[model samples]
Target: MNLIEHLKEDVRFEESLKACMNCGVCTAICPAAEFYDYDPRRICDLVQRGDEEEIEQVLRSDTIWYCGQCMSCKTRCPRGNVPGELISVLRKVSQELGLFRHSEKGRQQVLLMNSVHRNIMEIGYCVYPDRVDPDYHPEQGPIWRWYHEHIADIAPKLGANYHGAGPGALRDISEEDLQEVRKIFEVTGGTEFSEKVKKNS
Candidate 1:
């Protein structure tokens, strides 16, 4: 099928993904693949086959949701396949399919993304959902705080730079957006965990 026609229905696997070696290295490290039926290798394989039916089922499966997009798979994939990016593509398709507009977790994820964009856009980085890390030590705090306080330095480590500042930023977030993230965190208990991480940091 042509690109336009494919976009109208199922997401094409793309030639880049068809290069997968099926070495299972991705599964060896995947936290979700180990426990769930989802496998990055298989997902890539199905996408390569243009098996829209099974691929659609895979999209809704916890497989897509459980992917952390850590890029560990990407960095390690000898074939240069980006499993994380593929998952993001699947997720967008999932949303366009009206799959997420109905699910509770999907609703929560959308809420979380809005909150994160708002907070980081204004604050650079944040101790979001405000959850503290119990394992936090004075020498090193949890990932969020460490990322927030020194984003200029730590962000590069995470692969993205944290670049945003107050009303001067491109998008101005309202008070509602800030509160929205906190509320989401409240549901996720991120606030409590953030406090713990920051205190130690």
Candidate 2:
């Protein structure tokens, strides 16, 4: 299928893009636009035009990855278009087509696969405390270092299970439950998607 056809295959494409009057409301409210050279309004316009070459350029660019998926654009859109949701469709298509490797931000999917995806598949937590080593995450700074060092003590105080069993924050997920999680991913094509991201990266 072509880029537009691939995009249309995603349910979010039709749901997110009803109409775009180019009012730029989505861009105005987008947090990513302030931090990056991203414009949700422009993305909507580009996808709405159904220009295959333009859409392919978008799929290969960093613009799609710039969306944080906070869904803030959904709140204020006069036409009820959800640019954040549209970005999700674009990113998925990019990854499936292996075009994500063409951009710097898109290539970060490998790191995410290693960290978040690995954590989920193994421990059933996307951001497991143990995997969040401060050495790799320097931006976490001294406080995170202190927390990392004293998580055993701090976690208990904060009512987190912290790798322990039973129901609580940061608790250890049972093997049975982890298997269930894996099954969900497998059935949902998440495992296939992860493999695609790895292969593309």
Candidate 3:
């Protein structure tokens, strides 16, 4: 199938994009648009126009990755188009086709896979407190370094279980529960999708 035909196969493409009147409401409300050079209105126009070349270019560019998937555009769209959701579809297609590796932002999928996704499968939490090492995540800064050094002491004082027993913040998830999480990922194609991102990146 052609690129447009492949895009149409995704249910998100149908649900997110109806018609874009170019009113620019989506662009106006998009946080990513404010921060980055992204224009949700223009993206909608391009997808609506169904130019295969342009769509392929979008799949390969940082434009699709710029969307934070906040879905603010969905709330104010005059034509009821959800540009953020459309970006989701575009990102998935890009990963599937290995086109995401063409762009700098898209290549970060590997890091996401190794970090958040991997953590979810192993620990049953996307961002486990122990996993956020200050060395790897220097962006967390000196305060985080202090927190990391003292988390075992400070966590309990703040009412967190830390690495201890049943039920509460930062408590260890049971092995049975972790197995269930892995099963869910396997059944829902999350594992397959992560593998695709790894392969493509």
Candidate 4:
């Protein structure tokens, strides 16, 4: 299938790309462009021109993955284009095509999908503080490490339910609700995508 046609079917991508005048505003406002070899303007041009080879090249490269998805370009585009949304479309296409394995950072989606999705399915929280290993997530800082080590003791003091039933932070999630979450994941292909990412990565 033609890549542009496949991408155009996505509502986000369809709405995001109105036109590109090559004004360079999106690239100028992109934070990723400042730090990495990423340019939203370039992506816009490639997609606008329907350069399938270049678009596929971008999907397999670090360029598409460099987008922080902060939606800065969406807010700043002179033509009302959404470069961030366009990048997301590229990413999803790349993942579906197994092209994400071409980049170092892209390969880490395996770990991210495994950790975050597993947490969501099993615990009903996308991020459970206790499950975060300090060794792996050093950027979480020493304070988070201390919190992880002492959550049981500190949670009750902070008015958190901890493992107790019902609502509020760290409370026990019901099995029924957890099953519902798993069903949602199954229906939405979240589980399949996670497994695919893991296998490909």
Which candidate number maximizes lDDT? 2
Q: How close is candidate 3 to the true structure, as a TM-score?
A: 0.93
Clashing pairs in 4: none
- lDDT-superior candidate, 2 or 3: 2
Model 1, residue 50: C-alpha shift (Å): 0.5
User: Which lDDT tens digits does candidate 4 get at residues 1-201?
Assistant: 588887886779977899989899889988999999888998999999998888888888888889898898888888999999998898888887788999887887787787887789788998877788899899999998999899999999999999889988889899999999899889988778777877888
lDDT of 1: 0.57
RMSD of each: 11.6, 1.4, 1.5, 1.5
Which stretches in model 4 have alpha-carbon errors above 4 Å? Answer: none
Ranking by TM-score: 2, 3, 4, 1
Error of 1 at 191 (Å): 26
Model 1, 68-138: lDDT tens digits are 77778877788888777777777655555545444444444554444554455444344432223334434
**Model 3 C-alpha lDDT per residue in residues 1-201, reported as the tens digit of each score:** 388887887898998899889999998888999999999999999999999999999999999899998889999997777889999889888888899999999999999999999999888889976789999889999999999999998998999999877999999999999998899889988999999889777
Count of clashes in candidate 1: 18
State how far residue 92 of model 2 sits from its true place (Å): 0.3
Question: What are the per-model numbers of colliding residue pairs?
Answer: 18, 0, 0, 0
User: How much is 100 displaced in model 2, in angstroms?
Assistant: 0.8
CA lDDT of each prediction against the hidden true structure? 0.57, 0.92, 0.90, 0.86
Lowest lDDT 10-residue stretch of candidate 4: 1-10
Give the CA lDDT, 0 to 100, for residue 17 in model 1: 64
Worst 10 residues of 3 by lDDT: 1-10
**Candidates 2 and 3: which is better by TM-score?**
2
